[model samples]
Target chain A: MIEKILLLTVAVLLSGCVNLHVHFPDAADKTAGGEVPTRPADAGGAAK
Target chain B: MLLRTAVLLLLLAPLAGSAAQITLSLGSLRHPSFEAEGVMLSFDAARLGEADIRLGVLRVAGTEYRALKIHCSGFYFDGRRLDCPEGSVRREDERGRDRPALPFSLAWRAEDNFLSFSMHDVDAVAFSPLVKRLRSWQPKGTIDFGLTVEGDRAWLGLAVRDLEFASREGDVSGKAILLTVAAGAEHRGGAWQWNARLDWSQGELYRAPWRREAGVIMEAAGSLSETTLQVGLVRLDVMGTGSVNASLAWDRARGEATEWGFVTERLDLASAMDEWVQPWLGTLDFPKWYAAGHARFSAEWKAGGLRRFYAGLEDARVADGTGYVELGGVNAQIPWEASSPTDAEISVAAGRLGDLPLGGFALPLRLDGSEATVKGLSAPMLDGRFVIDLLRLAKRPSGWHGEFEGGIEGVSMPKLSRALKLPIMAGSLTARVPRIAYEDDVLRLDGALAIEVFDGGIIVHQLRLMDPFGKERRFIAEVTARNLDLGMLTRTFAFGSIEGRFDADLHDLEMQNWQPLRFDARIASSEGDYPRSLSIGALKDITALGETGQPKALERVPERSGFSFGYDRIGLSCALRNGVCLLDGVAREGEGVVLMRGSGIPSVSIIGYNRHIDWEALVARFREVIAGRPGAIIE
Candidate 1:
């Protein structure tokens, strides 16, 4: 069961990376745009 | 033109024949690539002599340096060329403090617009403007660099020491970095063809899930156009890790990689997982994993998605740090393509999941896009064979979903029980799980799982598990067991001996994290014409289950030659809710419940006076009974 979960997690993580859209923080204004990239909403749960 | 004007003005200066002092001042000078304001120069014209030059502001390649000063003790000039053989450059801080001077050399030829400059031990922060153009991180350290430009070609050599940098968001950061970079570029066809090499020997870096700690070298050849950057090949070698060869095409305007692919040399799986993969699993409630062996991996990304991926594992072994799961002697070749179906195979020598030891098995798999399928996968499981006739899984935007049909056959009950740390039991268990499905984070059984054991059958119905791998995992099911021999059950559990057959019904059973939360449970002697008897020890244990200080009928029974009694029937019921159980027995007798009724001579009735008991307390008493500490007396 754990092996299966690990495999599923790898697949999901890869898919998530494929769809990732990076937003670089604005260099001119440090406080204006310094947010970590958003993670998928459903990424919190175990891979079912 | 600016250099010509300065030279012309110096030639017209008064010369004292043998050694003449010449000073030239320009309010401002400008060129396509360079600009300076309030420039001043003083030097001897007859021979090589001391020279001092200062500029209020100097701009080169879109970067500005203010309050810059250069002192050359051996400056020479001839017709159309100028040289600063030995010099030092300094910049005044905002508070008017002169920074430490850095040694430099300069040579220029106005004949063909050729220039060369080198500086050593220069503060890396002074080059923030150039670094900012490439990334938003702020750098601090020292650098030694040289640049040469002739026509439309340029060469650069840079070495940075003790560099520390971080982006404002902290997603990218490095510390104590020591590296050397050499790059060259030539303009051709309105673009720059560039090749570069970098050797990094020290530093720890964090760019989200990618971290590096020293010993890395990268060599790349690429072209940069106005809207795109293309790398023909990039070879990255990481010390003590592995190497990767890749190519990429990036759209500058879109700030995205249009296409990229990489193939890794056989990589050490243990190190790779710790360095690159663990961070992606941040804070997850998963067992830490340790891996061994080597694997080759390749992947391609195109059109903004992963197009293909392949992995070949060579005798790999992965184990859970918590000792719950392990796979040893595993080898597999897995290939997945977005546009086509592929076949893969994997073999394992031995494995374990929790307490169940697994035997070697090989499986064939098929992959197509986001779906995977397996047919007829079987493995030896604790004296039985676990067989999955078919398994299918698909990845959807909503999440992952899957289903499988499997069964456990001829598994020894004693072995299973011992493996699971349960009491030793007789007989073997066989179960047929028709279908199990997973969707929306829930795993459910479509049909019942019937396990035959102890000359009886246990049927589990309506089984559902929520968030099976999450912190708040929950399991719900209804179970029924028929005609289980009480003699075997008692002996197995170390409970006081009892004879006859019994049936149990457990409805609406709910458990969170494997702890019972709520249930309606009933156990009764099977209705049959059979001898029913309970040992004196069992009677004491049953009576002890009543509420503390509650009087029980078993106290009146006198000692007899045979330390046992005959009972007509036995029954008990408990409906649990909110940590409490509403208890009942076969029939109510006055203020008590008839747990056992007398049947023959010397028989005694057993009654329970408590109708409400704490569930935990009841379980504690049951454990005590099973452990042979009856905690009750009959005098």
Candidate 2:
């Protein structure tokens, strides 16, 4: 059990040095009449 | 029907003014609705003030009308115009049905081929055969109408009062409706152009299609054209507690809505749940969660399902009556379409959860069907920053699941302890958890959470929590603390100053509702550690662990020997199970073990003879040690 804890602690310390990055898409332009297209059909394809 | 009735009445009026006995034979007249034949008119023109006109039979559509009569009074006719002051029309029936006498007035001009007619207090409900042929449902109402026809152009206006409409097939019924309508049509240049205006008041609909509550007063105005039908606006007030404004346009050919929108203005969420949401979900109660907000919503639907839907909320707040949870100053905008990630930005200015004061935070969320992902969300917590790396929450058929990774860094332990009402402990705590996942109400952590405290490191592993949000929650974990400076730990709790290095292992620890259920805990001196000594107060507290323990040589009531005593080693263990702790000591002494062994001048030692102890009693003993009242251990 002590060995397992030591291993987990080491893994957590290693993960602390790493970071994950995410980029958000730009918002769509708003019009005077509040007309905007639905989601772009291919917007989520790259994300998936 | 109005045009045909006017022409026949005008022919009778002129004959009554001839002042001579005349037999009038009228040829057959054909109309799109019916063919009229065998028409004979006879009237004495000497007394033109009153006339009695009778027709044998009039066929309209497929229904045969027999014994149709018109009684006219104060009738006048000239070469160009005919007028009737008062008249009554009736169609006799064989079944002895009592029908109301329709009172009407008519004027006809032959020079312009023009006719105008007006009728008042017409009980159209008595025309059961015509009503049955027009619609499947029965409508009881009183109608007042006027019609004018001039050379291929027509205008009609009608009003209905006290309308009661019901349908047995649809289980729908409503009462007290008033409707006003006007329509005009012109047929010129081989085409027909038409327009209509419909206005209704005090209309309450039952069993409406969506989200419409019963007994809600609804007002609507719209117009209809040859190509499209439009609802200009519809306003509904739900018992004056909530309201909605909506408008829509329908495509005549496609028979579907082309453009539709609605805005909810200041709806009381509690009352709304009582009226709509609870009934729709078939749930009895909403668990004391409520909100009041104003929202603007718009949607466009095409041949396919949904083209676009948008909703924005402003000045929204949610809270419970008990003040346990609250959220205020919430604003959000969400836009969704077919097969696209529903990305939305949400901001909450202030909130509270279970005695924890929450600060303002903004979150960017993307939802794809059942999964939701939130990235880089951070908030201030207890003089430190609580940061989440990546959180993915999923909604499954049974319930909800989540995966979260985050850490609390550089938090002041003393401040946290004060906030949580814990025993004052001094240190700066930094904890990092790599991964925590939850499923089926059970949360599991993959990696250890390392906490730097007490000039040492404590690692927590194998942590699992069941029903964390439910009434009864259970926690299981294993903790190991190494090389903790004992002086610091002792001073933090004010548990009788002791000088040594400490190490411990707490395994198989289980707690239910924050109360310990079972654990195997052992604390002992670390190997080759520093100046080992125990204060007289500390020695007295250690001896109190057993029922009868006395180290008389260690105590100095006179204070002549100072306040300290030497000890070679000190250790104790409790293997707790079922509210009982199986006690043990460091070194074997006879059948038991010496819990504390004194080494040098003015030496002292203590032994524990008791093997079994109640876990709660041992806890109380430790509390007393912290209170500086080590009671009578030498006895």
Return the top candidate by lDDT: 1
Q: What is the TM-score of chain A, computed separately for every candidate?
A: 0.36, 0.37
Model 2: pairs clashing at backbone N, Cα or C within 3 Å: B19-B45
For candidate 2, what is the lDDT? 0.63
Q: What shift in Å separates residue B514 of candidate 1 from its native position after superposition?
A: 4.2
Indicate the DockQ of the complex predicted as candidate 1.
0.01
How do the residues B120-199 of candidate 2 rate in per-residue lDDT, one tens digit apiece? 77766544433333234566777788877676676778887877777766657657677677877665544334455556
Which regions in candidate 1 have their CA more than 4 angstroms from the true location?
Answer: A1-48, B1-110, B117-140, B151-153, B167-169, B184-194, B224-228, B281-289, B320-324, B470-473, B512-514, B524-530, B543-563, B568-571, B575-601, B608-635
Error of 2 at B408 (Å): 2.2
Distance from true position, residue B606, model 1, in Å? 3.7
Q: iRMS values in order, in angstroms?
A: 28.1, 29.3
Q: Write the per-residue lDDT of candidate 2 for residues A1-48, one digit (tens) a residue.
A: 999999998765443221111111112222123322221112111111
Q: Judged by lDDT against the true structure, how good is candidate 1?
A: 0.74
Best by TM-score: 1
Return model 2's CA RMSD, one decimal.
Answer: 17.9
